[model samples]
Target: MRHVDPAGTGRAGAQAQPDDHPLPTPGTLPDTSVTDPAVNHHVNPRTDDLAVNPGTDPAVNPGANPGMNPERSSGTNSGVGRAVNPALNPAVDPDMNEVVGRDDLLLVTLDTLRYDVAAELAAQGRLPNLARHLPGGVWERRHAPGSFTYASHQAMFAGFLPTPATPGPHPRLFAARFAGSESTAAGTWVFDTPDLVGGLAKAGYHTACIGGVGFFNRRGALGSVLPGLFAESHWEPGFGVTSPTSFEEQVRRAEQVVAALPAGRRLFLFVNVSALHQPNWFHLPGATKEAGDSRETHAAALEYVDRHIGRLFAAASARRRCFAVVCSDHGTAYGDDGFTGHRIGHEAVWTVPYAHFFLDHGEPTT
Candidate 1:
């Protein structure tokens, strides 16, 4: 559970030759002094003409006037300035808009991560790959819409986020649409329509869910609460709270799902990991079942979970068609403020870790 600042803030091809365009090669230090002639070529004709003016002494121009350009006189200024070629700046390219829109999106839910823990782990390099991918991409203090999984997830599906403690005067709509409202012809809902998964599907994106919590297992009428939102959903055997390898197994299945997707189709995948939820004692290597509830046990569980999270990220990167959103459904209380577990109104139970990362895509824009 690590928190980093959110700052200002793909693909394809095949047999095509490596882009001859000069890009900073990965794993190599960039030479600051070197400039690409194609990108940084500067020619000021006015300055050139002034430099060759016969009245000025060439020796004086170079040696006497340190600040002035050799081609221009100290007293006179030229209006002409260097202009960047449109071809060199990607921002101005028409194709750039298309490229940005076509990239994939990934969203993850880290079932009960705390903000403080997430920050500690992130700072300690427990999540190096994620750190590298998203240097300033973490937001720690986000408010969960609900205090527990079922309620909070319902809000999430409806696009209603917990109201930020330091909220602005403007009313923000959490879900794409409000609940019990009609949808426009564009498929945009006026109110919450199941959840964002359903909205995405209506928008022509294939939706998939890899659920871990019992509420999402679709075992009975209760399972229908959220699983139906996705086009395909899975909850394997040994995936319940009693199972130890639940999180890892889910990641393995997620990798398989991504591999099996039809080529060239847009996809939306959501996963809920259960390892860090509660009864985290089994996460430690040699700790016996008798191990008491302690911070050490929590740390061990988090570390184990972090390893699996790293695996999921690696798999997504390999597929080159995913974006990940890693966050917590809610925070669990650990005897802080006289509170023992979650589903209570303690700061520890309210504040959770939330972060979003994209694969093979640049920073997001408004």
Candidate 2:
């Protein structure tokens, strides 16, 4: 069985014609470093962030101690999977209060991408689309909240994202009101309802979703659960996990959605890129789906997706100011010690790449 990340600290959309504004390069964004943990240390039960322990949180259900992860962590190899302590780490991007209504939000999930693969490719210059943020944003190793799309995404939409393992606890930036949590940081957005879509809706942002795989397809009873979280969600057969043109088709719809939105209306756009999920043999001539899931295949698929992502970047370039989160829900195992896919326990399945950056069309604000 693949080993998912233990509940650890870890911590969208619109459409219609885009305004003529060009993506402005803010002089410099404020560092995302959070306030001293000492201030956020006191847990307030009245707050909205979820407070379950990663190991024992029923929502995540993985083991508690990350030190026991046999495959990745050992006494001898100290650099492989170190958690960046949230207490000391600064926020990589602006907080909700800063961007919510003022800037459009674009949330992107790169399904099944591994940390090592993404880093290697980016280092090799194969991902120019993702490279733009390298100088000003973060590209750190973040542990996934779950081992698969359904489980991981649920945690994300709830605002319980992957935590850096630096030793101290990191307060959540946003959370569902249902959990009765008290870990929300100051200025964070706390949802009064279970669904975050409801929270964003309250803030006047037009929320939309573009589904990439079956889990978000809305084709059946179970498939609709995730997509239903948004005010508007869309999917097509061509966007399935294995479809060769999945990214291209998704970009087409995204372009339309961005182009049709009326000016001055902020968007909360969510997208799940499924091309790298599975049965990606089409990326490699002789690879078989049964055994085609590999780092090699993942790299090729990432390049393909990155190219398409550039198109969305182009569309977002027209907005006044935009905030984006580009990350992987979880990594996958390619026969590592015989673990072939995600969902159980494997280091490769838990570690993912995370980044946060802003795109603005106007000058910086004081």
Q: Candidate 1 — which residues are off by over 4 angstroms?
A: 1-101, 137-139, 162-165, 169-174, 178-194, 317-321, 361-366
In model 1, what is the error at residue 273, expressed in angstroms? 0.4
lDDT tens per residue, model 1, 106-211:
6677777776777677777776544555437445466777778888888777755444446532122223433232211111122224556655444344466778
The lDDT of each candidate is: 0.53, 0.64
Least accurate stretch of 10 residues (summed lDDT) in model 1?
A: 1-10
- lDDT (10s digit) by residue, model 2, range 100-196: 5566778889998888888888888888778766544236788899999999999998887776545545555555543334444433555556766
TM-score of 2: 0.71
Task: Give the RMSD in angstroms, all C-alphas superposed, for model 2.
Answer: 17.6
Q: Considering summed lDDT, which 10 consecutive residues are worst modelled in model 2?
A: 39-48
Every candidate's CA RMSD: 21.9, 17.6
State TM-scores per candidate.
0.63, 0.71
